[model samples]
Target chain A: MPENSVICLKNIHKSFGDLKVLKGIDLQAHEHDVISIIGSSGSGKSTFLRCINLLETPTEGEIWITGEKLKLARNKKGDLDASDPRQLAAMRARVGFVFQNFNLWPHKTLLENIIEGPTQVLGKSKDEAIAYAEQLLRRVGLEERKDFYPSQISGGQQQRVAITRTLAMDPQLILFDEPTSALDPELVGEVLGVMRDLAGEGRTMLIVTHEMQFAREVSNKVMFLHQGQVEEFGHPDQVFGNPTSERCREFISSVY
Target chain B: MFDLKGFGDQLLAGTMVTIELALASLVVGLCLAILAATARLSDNWFARNIALAYTSVIRGIPELLTVLIIYFGSATAIMAVARLFGYDEYIEISPFVAGVIALGLTFGAYASEVFRGAIIAIPKGQREAGLTIGMSPLKIFWRITLPQVWRLALPGLGNLFLVLLKDTALISVVGLHDLMRKTTEAVSYSKEPFLFYSAAAFIYLALTILTMVFIHFMEKRNSRWGDK
Candidate 1:
């Protein structure tokens, strides 16, 4: 592992009973590396991102987050599980996840949703969490809607709030699982703009997205996943401009 | 024509007792239902089986029979235990206490199924979102999951509560001076069974109507964050 590596996954494999989803994949992300993961719908891009946080619990692999390894054991059901629950939670605390559907708590207001992680899990004082939450909400241009419920907001605004909620944790790495895929075409740019700004500020981000052009413009590196493996990984220019793999070239051309 | 002057006060008192019994049992039953529903949804095999057994046994028995067993059988069960310590004094259980246990247990059995369905109705992503944010499982259930569960379970619970209120009349069979018992006493003395029973029916109808109004307000309150 590199000294500055933020997340490293080695030989990750995942299976759902008879179906093998992720076949032996490895990825090492360094500090300030904004990587865009692009592939077809069933190509395992979301599963790969979920594995980093132990959400899916890779069937066989080594996951080291900032030099600390996640220990896994086979439970009685023969499925892999984090050996130590506290360790898994502690590691998860350092990572943020934004879902494709913008899974905000519908019962809570926008401000309360953002401050929940900091106050409940991180143990920040109410006043402190509120202050930081206000700052994040303002950045997303959602300061006025802080008191509104998630259902009352537009889809694009809700996705931005979801990102802001993840950012409230002040995590070392953030994972975006098709964050804007559920948004309308006109609303996609607003969410992509927030993500692009995050990349500009040197946040470590792993985005599984279907936006080919946005991925090319915002990401320092682009990873093309083909059948649960890293078919092509390099600078956006190299991977998108001139891919070496025939499958990679074909996939890129199809998307473009 | 019925003369209400003789037993009007007694019937009103019985109505109060009936209301108290129903409220107490409802409170206890709601707590039990939440606990049982949580157990049913838990991963522990022992707890799941225990909760399943409780709901199954209570729901299978007739509510009146449960009241009778608790009222009549409790004294024997208590004395048998007391005999173990050589203190064999006969003890009597309060009819109110017995009534609460019987009705609460029955209500809980049906309501727990309602609660379980509500918990399942919530989207899986809500829990996953909480888990990925590093919240403990307990915190996720209380802070994230339970509030939503209550919203989803409100209408079902409301119906169960109304049934629970009416079921309190079953306690009258166990020698408690509830609305039905007082009305029966009045009728026997007055020989105007039709008039006294009609009064009792009116009282029950009033209570049910009041309860429905309260439930309507609750449903409205819960839907505040929902559709515009």
Candidate 2:
């Protein structure tokens, strides 16, 4: 309810054909907050991240992005859809999403992939988008690989490019869905390093991750979700070092 | 003996006509294939069923029969429509137009299946990436979906193009003066079936070889990313 809140979810609920995945969850993200969502595999972590952008439309809830509430109504398909498509698209533009598998468009080069979202969606000129893309690629130590296909690069490098691609949009919020889960154990560290840099820059990010160490070190606030509800949420030290809920304690002990 | 000097000009002209017919039908067939594939994959029940029926009926019949039906059958239907409008000046379709329509319809039916498979092969996350970036649906198709589909469909579509090229010979039966018809007329006049028909066969082979070269070049250029 504060003025600085960038994302607010009130009573978020999602179900798939009688199977309720996310149940009545409420969370608020303020400016420059790096919130880490950690949970077991089937605890609706990925689905919750997708719902933030209406990728998997929430069955019942109101999602406010930077204080603008999304308009939703039931369509003939008996699923909730946005009443105004243009508004929905505009809302989506305000947030960025990074996938687990690093879904870079294979036909285009790294530079082209990075510039696509900024030029195509943000209405930035090609020259401007290219310049920004080059800077971001350089930051990720990938300026030399700008012309390479995603398949030609290592999985870690591909994920870095995926992050740069999302960063080029300059979105208010960046939602990461298991960004390093698909990478090999050796490659996971490189991706986590890049994310640590972003968190240092005070970016508003919500990452659904299984990396317990990264969650503790990189995020200011950590949320422990269990069975589609927040079991514990507080500062990283309090939640991880001293979890209040029995389930949270059990999850942390099992993982660590 | 061969009348190379005298009828060489006619053969060349017929070859040009055949190339033009093939290109026109290709353009028409591409449009038809895109429309048909979209309909087949779409959510509309009526559109899907209509597209399914079209592809099934066209694929079931022989290409030659489809050409015949499009040529004579369309003429009959058009004449009936003209009579209803009280215009009886004997409106007839040009042979070139009829050949293009007939051959193009058959090419489209076959190409639709290739396109459908290509579209299905693309990962769902590609579209989600586009949507997250706020690209319009039409823009997404042109930018994201089209390039991948073209890459995936190239070899299959290249094969279909060859089949479409050879099918132009069937148009000669409707008297479009294509490569085969020119060869037939030249044979009748010269009485040297061996030389004239053999020359025509060589010309068809040359055409195929040249087109294959272009297709081969395109395949090489586009496959660079797949090298790894």
Candidate 3:
């Protein structure tokens, strides 16, 4: 792994009993790098993104964030360490994750949803959290919709709010699990636009997306995942323009 | 052989008692229900097991048996405690208190399931969002979980309340002057069982209708927040 890498996953393996999902995967993301992961459905792309945030615990291997090793402490028997509640909580706080379904609290307004993390996790005062919430909502072009519930907003708007909710934590890294896949075709552009803007501001992002055009336009590097392994990874042009691996060429052609 | 004046007084008094019993028990039952549901979902095995035991025992027996047991059993227990505390003389447990305890216990058992379902129905992500926002578990339960639970559990709670209202008649067996007891008393004096019983039935029907209207209003108000 590079010394300045923001995230590093080495020899990571995950499985669901009889079915293995991620097999000996090694990947690294540098600071402010927009890395898009593209793969066919059931290709373990979502699982990979989830593993980065520890939403799904990997069966084996290690994840390092900003140079800090995320290791499961084992007993004398060398069994996998089952994380205690406190450790799991601390790990979750550093990585902000946006779900594909825009899992906004249905009971809270957009403004409340954005303010929740800062007040709850960071223990910010209510007044300060509200002030920050307003600023973030405005940045997402959701100032007018602050009082609206999640059900009242469009999918694009909800996704933006979800992003702002994560940003409230001021996390060092952000993970997007098929962020725009659940959106309507027309709404997809608005969410992708917001993501592109975030990329422009040099935010470190790992996005799982099937949108080839989006991958080409926003990502500094694009990784094509095939059957739980990285088949090809490089600058968007190198990977998208002239494919080296047969698998990569076949995958890109199929999508096109 | 109808004693109109006596019937009027008894029926009015009974109606008042019925309302009081239902309202008091409803408040107490709901409070206990929330506690019981929280305990059922608690991390500690002792608390969860205790809550489970309470629900199971109460649900297993018939309502009449429960009412009788609480009425007599609590009176004995209270007197025993009083005796231990040096009040050796008779400590009468009032019929009103016994009725409240019995009905409240019954309502609480059903309400526990209602509360549990509501709490479980909420998406886990909502709680995660609550934690991420810096709300302590207590604040999260009150602000995020409880409000949504109330909305989701309203219909079930309404039904429970209606059942509880009807169950107030059970208190008549304990010498409480609720609708059923008063009706029986009026019927005996007036020698007109049909008329007084029919009147009591009408009153129950009216109360049920009023309660349904209130429930409808609540559902509408709560749903408005999420509606576009």
Task: Please give, for residues A107-200, the per-residue lDDT of candidate 3 as tens digits.
Answer: 7788888877777667889999998888988998999999998999899999999999988888878888899989889999889888898899
Candidate with the larger DockQ of 1 and 3: 1
| DockQ of candidate 3 against the true complex | 0.35
Which residue pairs overlap in candidate 3's backbone? A116-B133, A117-B132, A117-B133, A119-B134, A120-B133, A120-B134, A120-B135, A121-B133, A121-B134
- Would you list the clashing residue pairs of candidate 1? none
Which pairs clash (backbone N, Cα, C closer than 3 Å) in model 2?
none
Q: Considering DockQ, where higher is better, how would the candidates rank from best to worst?
A: 1, 2, 3
Candidate 1 accuracy as lDDT: 0.91
What's the residue-level lDDT of B210 in candidate 2?
Answer: 89
Between candidates 2 and 3, name the one with more favorable lDDT: 2
TM-score of 3: 0.85
Please state the error at residue A224 of candidate 1 in Å: 1.5
Candidate 3: which stretches are off by over 4 Å?
A1-5, A66-84, B1-16, B31-57, B76-92, B124-142, B182-196
lDDT of the candidates, in the order given: 0.91, 0.89, 0.84
| CAPRI tier of model 2 | medium
> Residue by residue across A1-256, what tens digits does model 2's lDDT show?
8345899988889888888899988889999999999999899989988888878888888888898888899867565678888888888888988999988898999999989988887889999999999999999999999999988999999999999998998888899999999999999999999999998898999999999999999998999999899899999999989999999999999999
